[model samples]
Target: MEEIKLEKGDFRKNIAVAGLGLIGGSCTKALRRTKTGKIFGIDIDSGVLDKAAGCGAIDDGAVDAQAILQKSDIVIIALYPRETIEFIKDNAGHFKPGTIITDTCGIKEPIIEAAIKYLPKNVEFVGGHPMAGNEFQGFDAASPELFFDTNYIITPHDRNSGEGIRVIERLAALIGCRRVTRVEARAHDRIMSLVSQLPHIVAVSFANLAVGEKDMSVFMGRSFMDVTRVSVLNRELWTQILEMNNSNIIDRIEDMIDILQKVKNALSEQDKNSLQILFDNAVKGKRMCLY
Candidate 1:
């Protein structure tokens, strides 16, 4: 891990973002808005490439990542966790020497392991997860402002150089992230299981209750809608994420079930005091963690 310095006030580097989905498209759009280097967009869909190019979000577009990888100083692999790993394994040799590759994958441990096993020694991999997004998917929902005022997490392993970490931090800031936090890869997954993955599971489970009900929408309120917003998820993508982080997610799910059981017990017993205490504890928890 040698120190490589970027010129002050001019850190423009050739950036390639592989995948033109929501996060990838947003990254390309933000980099373009900031005039940060030559940006190349890559996706399997030619229509997505055309859309991104038409919107001026990318300087160039391509289906093949080989040429882009060979020229890019920084490559953002914004794909699903397993797909991201496969992409690295499939194109390990194409990366430019000294290229810094970062990913926007939800789970980090597997991706980091894949990089360690498959990536060229000269190439560096930084694990990143932007703490932002809506219940939307694909390029059409992408926005340059998606990262604004959001937190970005970067998990660097022993293989990463200080210079590569700094470059990623700068890129996060350039894309309007309000804060950039460094965390261990496993620890990041643990936290995400509770704060992120668990919520989606809860939403999906709750939303599923409407499946057999007739005129369900007529009874839905803002509270139900708010709680279920994330239930409209990309099923395949979430299946991959949840499976990759299953251990952590399972623990959180168990905790969630225990809490829900407590509420159910209190209501069944008609114990008003117990219910009020539960509500009070929830209020305190929200204030402590979220406020």
Candidate 2:
């Protein structure tokens, strides 16, 4: 990978963010730290825009997406999955030539494909996903340190310009992310399906199994709490993620079910040898994840 060249106080382009939720608000807060340029925020929800302004995340706020994009040198598409694609199509013409666009959407394959089709020829759309977030949602949950020491993945298409990619890396560094990796869009979705999407599914499933049971409260313990902690995440966002990456997620879930069935058979038969093997293998596999 080539080193990105950026100097302190060198970035002087106005930035606009097309959403004022957790991801968008966090971008605003991070940009403020750089003292680079004026930040404008846009949201369909006026309440969210007002809240972002109140939090000092942006210099100005508006409900019109085009109006914001018109004045921005760079635009961050932080809307939900479906809305993100639509926003690009609806406002592509408003962007200045050579304006760099990036997104914080979780799934990349579908979104990047759509961007390639609908985005203006002069504008660049690079897919970015920061591997850090809390279960909480909304602007109130946004923090300036959200990306600190986190891994940020940027997936660029074939048409992406070299300079455009550098702009994104600089933005990630400005947000305090210490590590950045570049990957293809499809590869990103597949890898995340196993590491990120499957875990959320398992957490939600575990939580649901314990709900509405007469004796469930008696069996609750710290182990259950630790495992189901992320089950408290916003349902709307998780639903979008699951649906967007349904095929990859389903394949991963099937593989997990196979492992669970093996464990169940070992326990039911009181097979001590099988149980010990499973425990030892699990420990070894988990230890490999420490790096």
Candidate 3:
């Protein structure tokens, strides 16, 4: 791992992305515009590859993971947390030595742990989570501009080369990310468990609570709707994510349960002062947020 300095001209490199769903498709589109080298879309779905290719999002498409792994200087895997691990386990040996790899998976520690276990020493597998995407699924919903103004988080393994991480940061910037922040893998997972996974759980739970009310949607207001919008989720993908960051997520949920019990007790006791305190604290906490 010698010092690898990236220049504006060095932005052109053979890049392959696994999975062409929202994040992958968006990356394909963005990279196709910015990178001078070949952009390959690797996936099992020929239809998706065709769609991406037809729209100029990818230079070519391949179903063979090894083919892409062997050819690309960089690989961005946009698969589920577990699937990303399995993919690396199966294909990491096939990656050209010195090739840099990254992912768009939500949880980090598990993926980073699994990657380090399986990836070849010469290959750089930097655990990454591009902080973007919406409640949408599939390539059709992908916008090339999706990464614009969004944060990208990268957790480089201690075993990873310094140069590889720098390349990833520059690559993130080239993809239109407003900021790229590096965090320890465990810390990244811990924060994502509270900020990202817990919200989805809350949104889905909120929707689940409305089952008894058949016309709950009829009276839906902005606040409830806004909070539950992510309830329209890709459950399978999220199931993997929740499990990957299980311990951290469970800790946060336990904290939530504790606070909720306090709120419930205040309501049951008809304690206006206690209820007002909770409401005021929540407002103050929220006001501290940037957006």
Candidate 4:
């Protein structure tokens, strides 16, 4: 990787954010409230770009990423995990020297590894995860305050420059993140697999259980809706993410199976003590998650 001298004060000259979906659009909305330079947006859908620009999420829009990225000092790739990797590999050579690229991709290791391998030596890539979102999708559902008080995790690589990391951290602050922290990329993946990805899988599974059930909507309420809401997962993105962290996710799923099996056996035997213990343990664990 070649080290290039960046022009003084070209530090955060401009920003280009690709993929104007919920996270990307919300990021743009938040950054627009700051002194950050002109925000440029890139997406395959011209309609999305037009909508984002009209809604003030971006100052300009384009389908040609290289065209926008060439003039930008920072680039935020708010794309899916697989698309994020391919984007880096495909256009790495076009990124301006000293430009810092970061991503909102949920999983890290694969995207960061591919980016580290392909990005120009003059450019830097840092990984960021804003632990926030809605059950909704698209730019129309974006909110300027979406990430307010949310946890922003940064996983910086050894090759990353101090300036690059600071710039991203500044962006996090601009977007109203309540806390900013760092973790190793692999550990980030494993932990996220358990906390984030596994829940989505479990939700989808629970939803599937109702596929053929009749007249159950009458009994369904906040609890079922709350638990199964995320089951309406982004098929493409979650499919890749769940697969990427399959080992961690599978371990969690198997654990859930064992717990459920225990519950079934205890109920069948009419063991009040066992049932009490199980419910008591669940109550204790649930209390641990209080906000």
Q: What's the TM-score of each model vs. the native?
A: 0.93, 0.92, 0.92, 0.89
Q: TM-score of the candidate numbered 3?
A: 0.92
Q: Per-residue lDDT of 1-291 in model 1, one digit per residue for the tens?
A: 222233555547899999999999999988887656689988999999999999999989889999778779999999988889999999999999999999998899999999999998999999999998999889999999999989899998999888788889888888888888889999999999998999898899888998998998889899989889999788888999989999999999999999989999999999999999999998998998763
Off by over 4 Å in 2: 1-6, 214-220
Residue 57, candidate 4: alpha-carbon lDDT: 78
State the lDDT of candidate 3 residue by residue for 68-93, as single tens digits.
77779999999887789888998967
Query: Which portions of model 1 show Cα errors greater than 4 Å?
Result: 1-8
CA lDDT, every model vs. true structure: 0.90, 0.86, 0.87, 0.86
**Candidate 4 has which clashing residue pairs, if any?**
none
Best by lDDT: 1
TM-score for model 1?
A: 0.93
Q: For model 2, how does the per-residue alpha-carbon lDDT over 1-291 read when each residue is reduced to its tens digit?
A: 555556967678899988877888888888888867889999888998888888788989899877777788889988888888888888878898888999888899888988999987888998999887877777888888888888889998998988888889988888888777899999899989998988888898998998777887688899887778798867777788889999999999999999999999999999899989999998998998665
In candidate 3, stretches whose alpha carbon ends up further than 4 angstroms from where it belongs are 1-7, 270-272
User: Which residue pairs show backbone clashes in model 2?
Assistant: none
Worst 10 residues of 4 by lDDT: 1-10
Between 3 and 4, whose lDDT is larger? Answer: 3
Best by TM-score: 1
Error of 4 at 172 (Å): 1.2
Query: Which residue ranges in model 4 land beyond 4 Å of their true spot?
Result: 1-12, 269-291
Candidate 4 lDDT, tens digit per residue, 1-291? 122333444434689998889999898998887777789999999999999888787889899888998888889999999999988998888899888899998898888899879987899998999998978998888889999988888898778788787778777777888777788898899889777987888899889999999987988999899889899988888889988888888888888889999999999998889999999998998897664
Q: Which one wins by TM-score: 1 or 4?
A: 1
Model 3 residue 11 CA deviation in Å: 1.0
Task: List per-candidate RMSD values in Å.
Answer: 3.1, 2.1, 3.0, 4.7
